[model samples]
Target chain A: MLRINDLHASTQGKNILKGINLEIKPGEVHAIMGPNGSGKSTLSQVLAGNDAYEVQSGTVTYKDQDLLELAADERALEGIFLAFQYPVEIPGFSNEKFLRTAVNAQRRHRGEAALDAFDFSAMAKDKMALMELDPDLMSRSLNVGFSGGEKKRNECFQMAMLEPSLAILDETDSGLDIDALRIVSQGVNALRREDRSVLLITHYQRLLDYIVPDYVHVLANGRIVRSGGKELAVELEKTGYGWLEDEAKSGEVAR
Target chain B: MKTATPDKSLTYRDVFASGQAEEKSWARYAAKRESALAAVLDRGLETRGLEEWVHGKAAGLVAGDALPVRGEVAAAGSPEMARVAGSHLLVFVNGVFDPARSEIGTLPAGASVQPLSAGDEAADLGSVARDVESSFTALNSLFWRDGLQLILADGVVLEQPVELWFVNDLAGEAGLIPVRNLIQVGAGSEATIIERFVLGQAAVVEQPLTEVVCAAGSVVNHIKLVGGEAAGEHFGSTHVVQRADSTYRSWEIVTGGHLARRELHLDLTESGAKCDLNALYMGAGKQRFDLRTRVNHDAAECETRELYKGILDGEARGVFDGLILVARDSQQTSAHQTNRNLLLSDDAVANSIPRLEIYADDVKCSHGSTTGQLEDEALFYLRTRGFSPEEARTYLAWAFASEVIESIPVLELRAELSAVVTRTLDVVDDTLMGELS
Candidate 1:
C-alpha cells in the first residue's frame, strides 16, 4: 500500500538517501537492515514528510496519493506514524493529554466522534497494560526523566493508540534491554492487521528474532543491495555487515 | 548606584501641598508623608536610571491632569471576580473600599480583615516594609489613600483564604492609583492570600506595596496576580519577613499595563526559616514586564528556592533579576534560583540575570538563567503527532508556563489560569472583563 521510486533526499546540502526504491504491500512486515550511515533512518524521516529532508528527485505514493504533497501533521492524520529514534521530552505536557489529542485529531479527520475523558481513560488503561507500562506514565510529563526503555515503550504505546496504517519503526530497539525489546515487539505484533503495513528499520538482527519480518532487505551505502525472505537477516547477522561494506566500497571503486 | 527617581516631582509636591487642607483619617501621617517626599527628592529626579530599570523603567508619574485619589466610590465600578469558595473578598475601586460589593463574611475566630484606615498604620504599616526600600515603596507610602490590613491571631489556622481585588477604573480619565497592604500571620498561624490588580478605561500609574510578616512557626502563601487593561504603567513591590521556623511562599503572575515592574524582597530573619518564590511573567504588544526579587538569608540554617519564567511575543520585553544572599554567619543555609524565558517573535526581548551572594563558608547556593525560543525538535515532534502548527505552539508554550503555577491548590483556578495563558500568554481572560469596560 506504499511505494517509493528512486527517492533521493538530502538534509543540510548533504545527500543521504540516493535512489532508494521500496514497496510495502498490505499485511507485510519489511525489515530494512543496514549499517551505520546507510541512510535507513533518513529514509523513514523523508517518508514521514520531515521537511528537514529535501526531496531532491523521485516520488513517493501512499495508498495511491502523492505522499510528499502532505505536511507532517497531515501525514499523521492520514495514518502515517514514525516512532522517533529519540522521543522528545515535553516537560509539563501530560502523556495522557498528548495521547488523547493525537487520538482525537485522527478521529476528527475521519469524521468520527472525539473520545471524552471517561472514554479516553478506559482506552488508555488497555494500551498501557498491553505495553507493560506503569499506570502513572499516563499522568507524568511526556518522556521527561523516563528511562530509555520506558521512552521506547511509550513510543510503542502511542503507536498502539494511534493505530496508524503505515508504522515506521526507526531504531526503536537501539536503547532497549531484552525485556523491553520483547514487550515493544509484542506490542507491535499485536497491532498487525490485514490492512496495516510496517517498515521496520534497524541496524541489528536482534529485533527480528522477536517480530520476524516477512521480507528482509540488506541496505548499504544508501541502496538496497539485496532482498530475500527472512533468512537474509540471519545470514547478515552471523557474518555482520563488514562483507557488505567491503562490497560497497569495491563497487564504488569499479564505478 | 543608579536608581530610578520619580518623574514630575513638582506635580507630586504640589498635590501633597494641596492635600494638607483636607481633614482625613490618614491626615495623621503628615510627617511620614513629608519624610517620604524627602526620600523621593533625595534620589534626585533627573537620575531616572538603574541597571534593574534598563529593560523595564519604573513607571513614573505620567497621569496628565492626575486627579486626587480621595477614597471616593463612583457608582461602585465593577471588575472580573475570581470566586473561590470560602474566600473573604475585599474589592476596592480607585483606592476606595467598596463595602457594597465586598463579601467580608463572618470570618473565623481570631481572624480579622479591616480597612487600613481602621487600623493604626502609624506604627504598624512601615514596620515590615520600610518606605526607603525602593522609590516605588516610598511613593506608595507618600500617596496611598486606602489599603487592606489582614491579621491572624497567634496559633490561628485560617480555613479560608483572603482575596484582595484592587480595581482601578478612572472613567476615561488619567490618574494615579496607589495600593498598600499589610499582612501579619501570627506565630504558628497559617493562611493563604490571593491578590489581583485590575484596571480599566484611562491612563493610570499604579504604585502598589504589600508587606507580609510571617511570625515564628507560621506558614503563609501569597499569590498575587497583576494585570489590567489600563493604558499606562504599574510599579509595585512586595516585602516578606519570615521568622524562626516560618515558611513564606510567593506566587506572582504579572501581565498588565504598558510597563509594569514588580520588586519582591524577602528576609529569612531567623534559623530554620524557608522561602519559596515562583513567578510567571508574560508580555506582548510592545508591553514591558519587569520582575526583580532578592532573598536574604539572615540566620543560620535558612533555605530559599526561587523559580521564575517569562514568555514574550511581538516587540514586548520581559526582564528577570533574581538575587539570593546568604548573609555572613548564616552557615548551613541552602539557596537555589532558576530563571527561564521563551521569546516568540524575533523582536521580543528577554533579559535574565541570576545572582548569588554567599558570605558564609558552609552554605550551598546556585543560580542559573536561560532565554530562548521553543525547541525546533519539540515543535516538529508535536506536529508529527497530528497537532496543527498553531496548536503545537500553544500547547508547548502553555506547558512552559503552567509549571510555575503547578503548586496552586485549587484546580478550577489552575484551569482558568491555564486557559488564560493559552489564549493570550498574558494570563488575562479578556472575556472576563467586567462591566467597567
Candidate 2:
C-alpha cells in the first residue's frame, strides 16, 4: 500500500531523515520505535506533506502515485490522515463543523454527494461513541480547552469518521493514561481493514501491548538500524536503547 | 440664500441660511434650537486640534458646502429594506418621518411612538445629550426638522423590537440629513430598539443624535447599524443616562461609508446601575472609521464594560479612543475595556487608545489593546484539515470578529450581522470571495 525508498529530508537547513526505506502491504500494521529526536515524527510529517520539511532526496509512492507532489490538503483529500502528536487548539471553530467540512471535502473529491447537517450529526454521534467522547465536546470549539486525553481521542474519532486509506499515528500514545490508551487503541483497531494500512510511531512499548504490530523497526540517527518481531519491543523495554546505539556504532566501525 | 464654501468655517450663519431656513416652524423647541445653533457657531465643527477629534478629520469633511436638505423617498422593496424585515418599522426618508411608510400601529399598550413634531409632551429634546462642546451633536440639534419619539411607560415590556429605519435617497445631490431621536424607558420597563441607516448612491452627510433616558430598574438594548452602497459620510452621537438600578446595553456596527465617525457617552447616574458598550467596525478600500466612547461611573456600586473591534483592509484607516471614568464617592465600581484590531494588508492602519480615570481608590478597572495579523500556526492547522488556504483565512478572520458579534442579544440580528461580517471580509480578502460557493 505504501513504499519509501531512502527517504532523505531536512528542515531549516538541518538534515533530519538521512535514509529511511520502508514498505507496508495492504492490511499490514508497521511500527517505528525510537528515542527522542530520532526522526520518528519527522517521517510522519514528511509523509503528510508538511512544507516545513523538505524532501532533499527520496521517493514516496502511495497506492502507485507519487505522494511528494501533492499539497497538504490535497494529500488529505487523497486519503492520507496524520494524527498529530500535539493536536492544535482552534478557537471559535466547532469540532462538529470542522469534521463535517473535512468529511464533505473528501466526499466531493471522490465524486460523492455531500452529507447534510442531519446526516453528518448522526454519523458523528456514532463515531463519538466509538471514541467514548462526550457529545458536548463536539459542540465546543475544536480542541480548545480540551484535556490532553480528550484531544488524542478526538484524533482517533476523526480517523474513524474519515476512514482514510492510510493512517499515520504520530505519537498517538504520548499523553494518554492507561484507560485512555486502551480506548484510543481500540478505536484504531476497530478501523483496521484488508484494504487499509497503519503506520504507528511511538517511543514507548506500552501502546504496542494494545494495538500489536506485525513488525517493529528501531530508528536511530535518522536510520532504521534494527527490524524485528513484537518480542523486539518487549526486549527493548527490558533493556534500553543504549545497547542498540552501541551496537549500531560498532557495526559501522566493522564496516 | 448664500452657498457655503468648503474652505470657510462652518458657522451658524452658514447652517441657518444654508440648511435651517425652515427652523421657524419648529416653535415648540425654538429656544433649545437657538441655543444649540449658538453653540455650533461658538465651537464651529470639531477640529483636528481637539483631543477627541485628533484621529478624525470631521470638521474638514463637514466644512464643505452645508448639506442641502433632500426629501426624496426611497423606492419600496429596496434590497436594504429586505435585509431588515420582520420588525416593527418606523421609516424616515431624508431626515423626515414618513407616517405613511411606518408600521407603528401595532405597538403595545402603555407604549407611544410619535414624530417629534407632534408636540412637546415627549420632548426632553436636548436633556441627556447636552454636550455643547460636541459639534456633531450641536449640528443635529440645530437643524433636525423631525424625528421619532419612543416612550415606554412604567412596568411595561415590549415583546417585539422597534426598528427605526433611516433611508437617505438624496437623488444624487450632496446634502445634509440631521436626525434626532429621543427614547425614554420608564421604571421597571424592558425594550429593544434598533437604529439602522441606509444611504442611496449619493455623497450625503448624515448627522444623527440619539438620547436614551433609562429610568430606575429599566432595561434597554440599543443597536446601531450604519452602512450601505452610498459613498457618503456619517457623524453620529449616542448619549445614554442610566438611573438607579437600570441597565443599558448598546451595540454599534459600522461597516460602510467614505468616512464614518461615532461617539457614545454613557453615564451611570445612581447606585447599582450598569452599562455595556460593544462595537465592531469593518473598513475596506479608502474608507475610514473613527469611534470615541466614554463611560462615567457617577454613583457607588456601578459597573461598566466596553469592547471595540476593527478589521481594516486595503488602505483603510480605523481609530478607537475609549475612556472609563470612576468618580470620587463611586466606590466598588468595576470597569473593563478592551480594543482589538486585525489588519489584513500592510497598508491598512489601526490606532487604539484606551484610557481610565479613577478618582475612587477602591475600584477595579482594566484596559487593554491588541493589534495583529492571523496566526501562522492556526492557519496551518486549518489547512491540514482539508480546507483550502483561502477558506482557512476566511474562517480565522471570521472567528476573530465573532467574539464581539456573538454578544448580540437578539438571535436573528446576530445571524444577520455575522453574515455581513463574512461578506465584508470576503471583499477585503480576495482569495476567499467565492470559496464558500
Top candidate on DockQ is: 1
Among residues 3 or more apart in sequence or in different chains, the pairs in candidate 2 whose N, CA or C atoms overlap within 3 Å are B67-B176
Question: Each candidate's DockQ score against the native complex?
Answer: 0.51, 0.45
- Per-residue lDDT of B1-437 in model 1, one digit per residue for the tens? 01112344446677777666662644757788888878766763332466555555644553333334553344443566766776888877767677787897887798888877677653667777776755556667777777788989899988788888887776544466777888998999999888888866456677778889999999998888887783767777888899999999888888788788888998888999998888998888888888999888899999999989999999989889888888899999999999999999999999888999988999888889999999888988988889877678777888888778667765556766776676675324332221001
Q: Which parts of model 1 have CA positions greater than 4 angstroms off?
A: A252-255, B1-14, B17-23, B28-31, B44-51, B61-68, B71-75, B425-437
The count of backbone overlaps in candidate 2 is 1
Q: Is the docking of candidate 2 incorrect, acceptable, medium or high quality?
A: acceptable
Worst 10 residues of 2 chain A by lDDT: A246-255
lDDT per residue for candidate 1 within A4-122, as digits (tens), equals 88888899999987778888999999999989999998998898878788999998999999999999999999998999999999977889878888888889899998887799999
User: Candidate 1, DockQ to 2 decimals?
Assistant: 0.51
- The DockQ score of candidate 2 comes to 0.45
At residue B254, give the lDDT of candidate 2.
Answer: 93
Q: What is the TM-score of chain A in candidate 1?
A: 0.97
RMSD of 1: 4.6
The TM-scores of all predictions, comma-separated, are 0.92, 0.88
Q: Give the per-residue lDDT of model 2 (tens digit) for B1-437.
A: 11222323554566565544444334547677778778877877647577777776673245656543633433444334643455677888777777778887577888987777774555476888984857667777777777778889999998778888887765454567788889999999998998888866677788888999999999999999988862878888899999999999989999977888989999899999999888999998998899999898999999998989899999988999998989999999999999989899999999999999999999999999999888776776676667777777888787677767778887778778877888887645442333222
